[model samples]
Target chain A: MEIYLLILLIFMIIGSIIAIEAKSLLSSVISVGVVGFSLSIAFLMLGAPDIAITQVVVEVLILVILIRATITMDNTAIEGGGGTFPFVVSLVFFGLFLVFSFFAVQEIPKFGEPLMRVSERYLRTSAEETGATNVVTGILLDFRGYDTVGEATVLFTAIVGAFGILRRRGRKKKTEEDAEKVGILEDEDIKKDFEGF
Target chain B: MPDIDEEIRDTSKGMTSIVKTVVRFALGIIVIFGAYIVLYGHLTPGGGFAGGVILACGYIVLTLAFGRQIALRKMNNKAASILDTSGVLAFLAIGLLGYTGGYFFLNFLGRGKMFDLVSAGTIPLCNIAIGLKVTASLFAIFLALSIFGRFISSLVDEDE
Candidate 1:
């Protein structure tokens, strides 16, 4: 437990430092991924492996998209560095919260007893009732399927937004191409407009 | 089948040929595994999202080994968009079925005995729908990226 806390502390410190000190936008993005990955590990140790896996997968997808966007855009052009002032403020707030959480952690009843109680009563019946061996899956897809539908909608929205952003410029180009072919636009004007793309 | 993009590589190089062969073989294997994962998602530890991601990864590998034009030739934009829309439609249809059957989104469609590989009521169908939607959405995003990235790069070069 001490070792885990130490590792968490180390990761937090490194994550904060990287978020503050990294020169490139890509490095900062990676630093955030590292922080998220460590938190997922912490979730695992806290007996939430299913949550850990989901968090890790979501983090990976977000990180990949963020990194790709950062690489493709002009990230280094930001004047004062990547929002360092807000970072420091948030870090301080998070640190204070952590210190307070340690004190409050003792008073909180852990998951052990409740999980045990619930598992004893519900584990066997969940499969028979829901037809899923994995209780978490049953809970996610059966008991709380409405919530899953909402989650799927959120994912759908994100993909739609990304598709829109990526498609808009391409569609503009296609229209311009058509205009040039039909002699509605001059070659030089089309070239200049294309150059702005 | 169409003119497609000009072959960006010269076919006269032995080293390039070896690399191309290896890449094609790897991509083929990846696509197979991804398809298997998607098909057997409910019967195993895997599920729709994971399988869809695996399939997308395979598509990406194939795109790298071959090219966007060839990969898109098989998974054209129209086909992918249709699959994506249909998957969502299927999900909504199932939910409506549940509502009609006394509960919202309940697995009310039972064809056979419980505990059978294919008798998970609506779970397997849901998984397949999710897999199709996710794979199509991912591919659509990637297709836009590839096409737009190339377009943007060309613009930058033209200004120079």
Candidate 2:
């Protein structure tokens, strides 16, 4: 298991490198997706199957949306600061950050150990109180229900913003310049364009 | 197969006939699987977010397979917006309902036998609401982003 985790982490590092260094948008986006998928596997290896499941699906959808976005635009010219003084300085900072993070990890308890002491109460009472066998779900929906409400609010705001930015033409009774606009594409035109896609 | 293929072509509005044929079966199965994950979240590793994402992925796959027009026929962006709004409202409404008992999001209902489908007092309902909200929100975001990207690209092309 340790070996697998090590391998997955190594792959993730490679994927991150490719994601940053790739010349083409397609490869960069795909590599980042690889990184995401690898992290999900690592989560599963760490005995967090719920996080792994969410990560996998979210990663897939993000990949889809990213690929579409990149395909329609020009995104080939991404450059890291080439071998310059600032680049070297940034690299040193990154190394120092990593070392500090590793040191912080050493200060923490073992992987399976919990320091909060709150989760025990959750595990003991959640099933009886919330009637939910899954402790995570029970805690999220029952004990931390207020937090879920906040999350729902955030999601609602996001949807509202998206709709505001991309309202449909069909929603209106009439438009003075409907057919001439490129934003509102004809059904057949857009459909035929991706006939084989 | 040929008959369906021709019928699909008549629309001239999607991916290759092969993709259309396969998606007919796969899409429904994926959606159903997502719903299962949401409903059984309290008993399994999956819960609202994962299941909702999977549900949205079903619609995303449908759109990918059949193109925007065909996909929109099933559920347009506005409909998705409505569903997205309703989902969060349902969750809040449930939370408010909990107030009648004591606090916000109180587990007022009878805590039935554990491990049963109808066991979770308000957790299952919350899961369902969150699932609905997430599914619709994701799909709506995807549609808006994709269409907006295309529109921007078209504008750039015209400028060039």
Question: Every model's Cα RMSD, please?
Answer: 6.7, 8.2
State in Å the error of residue A194, model 2.
38
Model 2 chain A: lowest-lDDT 10 consecutive positions: A170-179
Task: Give lDDT tens digits, candidate 2, residues A1-197.
Answer: 89988889999999999898888888999999999999999998888888999999999999987886777676456766476887889899999999999999999998767786888888788777888889889898999999989988888888777767675444564343544465678778666655665
| Candidate 1 C-alpha error for residue A133, in Å | 1.6
Fraction of native A-B contacts kept, per candidate: 0.18, 0.82
Model 1 share of native interface contacts: 0.18
lDDT of 1: 0.68
Name the candidate that leads on lDDT: 2
Off by over 4 Å in 2: A74-83, A99-107, A166-197, B1-8, B151-160
lDDT of 1 by residue, B1-160 (tens): 3354344253532126666678767877866766665555444555667667666766655554555556666797678778887887887787778986798988896634544667657777777788788888887777666564553342223323
TM-score of each: 0.70, 0.83
Q: How well is candidate 2 docked (DockQ)?
A: 0.53
Stretches of candidate 1 off by over 4 Å are A1-9, A36-122, A169-197, B1-22, B35-44, B111-115, B149-160
lDDT tens digits by residue: candidate 1, A100-152? 99999878777454546666656667677767655665555666678867766
